[model samples]
Target: MSAIFNFQSLLTVILLLICTCAYIRSLAPSILDRNKTGLLGIFWKCARIESRLELQ
Candidate 1:
């Protein structure tokens, strides 16, 4: 029972750290540059193609 509690606490701390890192990265300028040229870039390209297909 005590072990389970300890494990849960450790997991919660790790999750908090990951969330904090993600939030910080989201606010950073480097993330914005990736958004313009990363997987999101490919996603947007596909979305445009789909829209054109629907219009035609």
Candidate 2:
């Protein structure tokens, strides 16, 4: 039970970190101008692509 709790807490922290990074990325001047190699960058690029598709 203790091990399970620890794992859950670690997962929550990891998710929170990702969300914070994404929020910062959104605030940048150009979301699509950044490198699209890392995990967050790739996700951001995909999101922008999808949004563009939806607008059309």
Best by TM-score: 2
Please provide, for model 2 over 1-56, each residue's C-alpha lDDT reduced to its tens digit, 9 standing for 90 to 100.
45346988777765555565456556772664466677657656654554465568
Runs in model 2 deviating more than 4 A are 1-5, 29-56
How well is each residue in 1-56 modelled by candidate 1, as lDDT tens digits?
A: 45346988777765555454455444673543456566656433433344455568
TM-score per model over all chains: 0.42, 0.43
Inter-residue clash pairs, candidate 2: none
Candidate 2 versus the native: TM-score?
A: 0.43
Please list the C-alpha lDDT of all candidates, in the order they appear.
Answer: 0.52, 0.59
